[model samples]
Target chain A: MRAEHIKIGTSPPISFEVGSGECLAIDGPSGSGKTRLLRALADLDPFSGRVFFDGAEQSEMPGPAWRGAVRFVAAEPVWWTDTAREALPPDEACRSRAVRVAAAIGLPAAALDQPLQQLSTGERHRLSLARALADNPKVLLLDEPTSGLDPAAVALVEELIRYRLLSGNTVVLASHDAAFSKRLANARIALGKKPLTAHAP
Target chain B: MSYVALTYWDLVLASLLLLINGAISFGFRLNLERSLAISAVRMVLQLALIAVLLKFIFASDAFWPTLLFAMLMLAATGYEVASHQSRRISGWRGYALAGGPPFAAGLVTALFAVTAIIGAEPWYAPRFFLPILGMIVGNALAGAGLVLDTIADGANRERQVIETRLALGQSRFVAMSDIMRRSVRAGMLPIMSMMATAGIVAIPGMMTGQILAGAEPGDAAKYQIMILFLIAGATGLAVLSAACGSVLLMTDERHRLRLERLQSNGSP
Candidate 1:
């Protein structure tokens, strides 16, 4: 599956591709359309382009099925629910997995019952990650997933990403953090620079 | 209206509350003077006009004019809600789509609860019709208005989040269900607050009006309870209808929020 043309706002346009099961990390300066690319691919942005997933038409498939595979988690997630328990799926298996994910990410077990307003920024971000991971998507996209986290939290998120990648998920993480990107990315895609750098070969 | 019952101290307290309101605006250095004055002027002028219109309109036995007036009021209420939420809601049709379901549902609820339940005279008498319709329209306005603002802002701000869910195989309505519930809950706060107050905060306008018009306080209080229940019912229906209608209206086959139409302030 890939995106073509991909214009957003009045900014210069960019396009790219994602082969099956290959984890790609979008690395560039802030406001470099990394999130935009993900949004466009997710069919969330208003763009003039073609996007396809696994030879099936993105526009042709039911939105639910298309979205079921393609998921994007924003840097600053807006939660619809106030409680952590309400945020995750009600299914026992998914709920227990979310609890495990939250604990691995350094969130307290009590966070599940606490109101969202009570959680710190890092905890909230972890909750967002846990929610996305619960959906168990084929395409797990993250926008600066560890940008605001402390060093320990960042390492934990990296561990989670690595775990997902090991599970054969197609992971695309967008970040400007070089050291973090190098550690987890199988291929790096950069944006918003004068000359293109293709080093994945 | 006994001066003995309403003492000079009661007058003093009401004035003191108004004075405190004015003082807080000044004390906090909040610059609300221009809008405050304008709002006060508009309130006075509008109420004076309504008083004059109601004097003659209430006395008339003819139902056609009253019905026309009620319909126009409902349309106005709906228009206010739409215009307040988005400038892109171009014309009557755009407003109608946003406004129609809530108004119809609210009116039906109000009619059933009032005539069937309260047993008002002449069935559609203007006295009952105007006040009952006014209450319905007023609450419906608040509920519809809340839905409009929330949905418009929600569709834009949470567009990506919503789209993410849809891409992940969540149906459009399923994606919005949580957000819709939250928005409607926020909308119903005012109604809930009013219900909490009732007689203790001074009788509501409907009951107060009936009392002044020579009805016994006990009789008016029963009617007030009925009106409150109907108004609450109408608001619930209006809010739910608006939320569901707006979501359906704004979604296409791809399940994307129709931003083009709203951004242009026109229907997609």
Candidate 2:
């Protein structure tokens, strides 16, 4: 997955590329554009740039088709359905894949039967990841997927990301958690709360 | 039911309540003090002017002045409703889209209910149409205003979610499906529920008024039922119209919420 010079607000555009099946972790403090960068690649945030999904450019394909192929998990992903079971894709293979993902992320199997409102924030985050995994996406964009989790939960999420990478899913994760970044990222990009300073004197 | 006259005490009590509300609102946040004062003055002036004009309207043999007054009221109310709601759209186009459908539906529905449904003798008579249209227009205005505000607020606040959909390759309409459902539901649910529970909860205003005027209970009930149907129809049309208005703002013919038009409030 590649995003070339994504522009937001008035910030000088920055671009980065991640090799297929590799993991690139982005870390920044609150208000930094880490999430924004994920969104731009996902096409949620408007920017003047290019995004490449495999060899195909995002510009050529229909936006919905593009979105389906490249999945994004929000920091606090909004669940529209009643329960975890309802959130998964309709395919049987997808459903089983989601179950495995959930288990690896430390979500109990019974969580699927419960209403979304019953899940804790960490549980909800994992459920979102489970949904993304079920879709069989080529590239996964995750935003603060482990921010609200405890150490054990974070470890589980790390394990799940590692598993996805091993299975040949390209990953782009945005977070402020240094511990998670150090463990997960093949390459690290440090960003600032505000645009980096440049001077003309 | 107890009969209460519009006596001096009633007027005093209403005024006192309004004043108390103002005082409390001011105490908590004086951010709107100047605007509030201007609104208070406008209300006093407008009502005072209307009271003075009513005497001349009723006493005069000619009906043109009275009709003219009603038209002015309709236009003012329509403008206020449209302008207040479509701040994001922010122009005459917004005003037209916001006010046009509701006004049309409310006017037509009000006429149908007042004339054919309730069997009023002179359907076009301003005396009947004016008051009934006021109520219909008021509801339409509220309904349109509610839907637009909800949709815009929903889009702006949950921008990340919306943008995520857009990015993932959903066209504007496809992407907005979940949000559209939520916004419309939030706006329209109350009106529908009120209609469902009308007589059981409390006698509606029109029915109670007709009963007070010594109309037969059956006739009053019929009239109230007609009003309910008209309101429901107007609200339904309003929901459709508000959605149509918003569709233009968000997307091109392809039905994509234009990336530029979608403001990012907390998107990052």
Candidate 3:
């Protein structure tokens, strides 16, 4: 995944590239455009720049197809429907993989059938990541993915990120955890209030 | 058949009924007296003027003047539609969104009824054309207004849910399909209820007018049914067009939910 001169909202223009199988972390304080940056990468927000995945420009592909390839997991995830299962796209492969990943995240298979209102903040966070991963996207954009998780849950999620990295999936993650960035990301960028600067990996 | 017209004395006695209603409102402290009085006055004046002008129009047999009057009525209805919305969409967007569909749909349906359904001699004759056109335009205006109000409320209430769908790779059409369906249904509800209760529970105004004009009861019933069908058709077309057009205005070419395009006062 690659972003060339990507400027989102009022933040400064940023340019970066992550090779296949690489993990990049966006580190910033609150209200520093971390969420906006991730949203721009996912094509969920209007931005002035170009994004390319696997030699295909985002504008070249249809919006649905492009979004499917590069999925976004919001910070405060919104589950529009009543159940976790309904929030997922109806693809046989994605459904099977989602069930497996739910179990891997320490959730039972029955969790998918449970009502969304029953899930705690931590559970909702995990389910949001699982929903995005279900599609097996080429580039996964995550904003504060482990914000509300327990230590054990955080470790489990980090392990899942490692697994995806090993499988050659490109990931762009936003968080305020410097240690977490060192632990998972090979490239790092810290965004400030007025401007942003990319740090060497 | 000849019918007796109400004399000036009969009309004077009818004014007593309005005075009685106004007195009742005042005694009850219902706060409706002022509005009731104002509306009564406006109704008398407007209807009197229309009756006089319509007689002249029917005698003149000129197409342009009649068409011009119909357009004036359509413009007023559109203005009323926009004003009724709680979240006002102003400027040309407001006018086009609220007015365009009803005008187009009502005109087409009215023309079809006069020419094909009734086969009125000289289809543009003001006597038949204006009345039928009034009925279609009035119903369609209300339906289209309901559609616009529903969409405005839905857009405000369902912002996050809609954005979720859009972000999940759903097309703009697919993302808003549920809300659009609900809005169209809501717009059609009043007409549907009227249709359901037409004969048994209530007598519609058109039928009452025809009867009062000395038409045969059976023939008046037939004409009422025809007008009711035309209203349903025109409202359907108007509501459909209004919902679809408003939805398009809320999104962009990138399939992003452009909620910013929606006017908001920054409250939840």
After the best TM-score superposition of candidate 2, give how far the Cα of residue B142 lies from its true spot, in angstroms.
Answer: 2.8
**In candidate 3 chain B, where is summed lDDT lowest over 10 consecutive residues?**
B259-268
Give lDDT: candidate 2, residue A162: 88
In terms of docking quality, model 3 is medium
Least lDDT summed over 10 consecutive residues: which range in candidate 1 chain B?
B259-268
What's candidate 2's DockQ score? 0.26
lDDT of 3 by residue, A1-201 (tens): 888988754667888999888999987777788888877777777888998999999888887788888888787887767888888879989888888888888888788889989989998888878887888888888878888999899888989989998999998988766677689999988777754448744
Clashing pairs in 1: A64-B169, A67-B167, A67-B168, A67-B169, A68-B167, A68-B168, A68-B169, B88-B265
DockQ of predicted model 1: 0.34
| Model 1 Cα lDDT, one tens digit per residue, B50-158 | 7677777878856786777777776787676676665334456568856685678667976786588767677777767777778777877787777767776777777
Q: Candidate 3: misplaced stretches above 4 Å?
A: A59-61, A194-201, B7-12, B24-35, B88-90, B264-268
- Residue range A54-78, candidate 1, lDDT tens digits: 7887778776677778887888876
TM-scores of chain A across the candidates, in order, are 0.85, 0.90, 0.92
Winning model by TM-score: 3
Give one clash count per candidate, in the order shown. 8, 8, 0
Q: Give stretches of model 2 more than 4 Å off.
A: A8-11, A27-30, A54-62, A77-82, A90-93, A115-122, A145-168, A175-201, B1-78, B82-97, B107-133, B148-224, B243-268
Clashing residue pairs for model 2: A43-B167, A44-B163, A63-B169, A64-B169, A64-B170, A67-B168, B172-B256, B250-B257
List lDDT for all candidates, in order. 0.74, 0.73, 0.84
Candidate ordering by TM-score (highest first): 3, 1, 2
